[model samples]
Target: MLNRDWHKTYRMPEHPTLDQRVDWHLAHAIACGCREMPDTIKREIEKRGLAVPERNRPN
Candidate 1:
């Protein structure tokens, strides 16, 4: 699960640009185990009632 609250929890890069939210979210998702990401990683993805599984699921 990509911590949606990464902006609050992780140390953001210095001088973040105005149009970098998607990159930020995608990075966070990858860190959390979102391997097969969709075409976009914006608010819509999170708001569309989708889910990202955590790492190491019991198989």
Candidate 2:
């Protein structure tokens, strides 16, 4: 189920910085379940040693 409300409210920036991408993905993980974070983003997060939110984990 797409979270239209969250999408409408939280558009990704045209040219996002690394921190912005991380923040957006973290928030999106909590607010919506439309899709998984992209592999590139996952790798970046891992490189930074940031913990993915619990809700974002695949079951």
Candidate 3:
């Protein structure tokens, strides 16, 4: 189910930096299950050698 309340509370910023995108998506993975993290964001995270959060992992 979509978490409309979470979406309303956590809008992504315009032209967000990579750090902001990563942080927002990580939080979203915990708070909402509406969608998968974007591939671009995942690539950037891996490129930076940062571990993807456990909650964001695919089943």
Candidate 4:
């Protein structure tokens, strides 16, 4: 149910669809959460110019 504006915000111009952009970001976010990134995944998101907010999601 993605609307045009939502699509616009999430879509990457270089990518074919918003889903592609979302998939990339989701992987990045997961990397951030993988044992807090420092002890696990490489920190590429900061290089990509993103600062993921450290807010815990409600269960």
Q: Please tell me which predicted candidate would have the highest TM-score against the true structure.
A: 2
Per lDDT, the best of the predicted structures is 2
How well does each candidate superpose onto the true structure, as a TM-score?
0.28, 0.72, 0.69, 0.28
Q: Each candidate: what lDDT?
A: 0.48, 0.79, 0.78, 0.41
Q: Write the per-residue lDDT of candidate 1 for residues 1-59, one digit (tens) a residue.
A: 33445435654468855335445555565565333444555444556564543332212
lDDT of 4 by residue, 1-59 (tens): 22344445554458436445444455434433222333111344454566644522223
Off by over 4 Å in 1: 1-10, 13-18, 33-59
Please give, for residues 1-59, the per-residue lDDT of candidate 3 as tens digits. 34778788899999999899988987887777468888888888788898766553324
| True-structure lDDT of candidate 4 | 0.41
TM-score for model 1? Answer: 0.28
Model 3: clashing residue pairs? none
Weakest 10 consecutive residues of candidate 1 by summed lDDT: 50-59
- Model 2 TM-score? 0.72
Q: Write the per-residue lDDT of candidate 2 for residues 1-59, one digit (tens) a residue.
A: 34877889999899999889888888888778468887787788888998776564334
Q: What is the lDDT of residue 9 in candidate 4?
A: 54
Model 2: residues >4 Å from true position, as ranges? 55-59
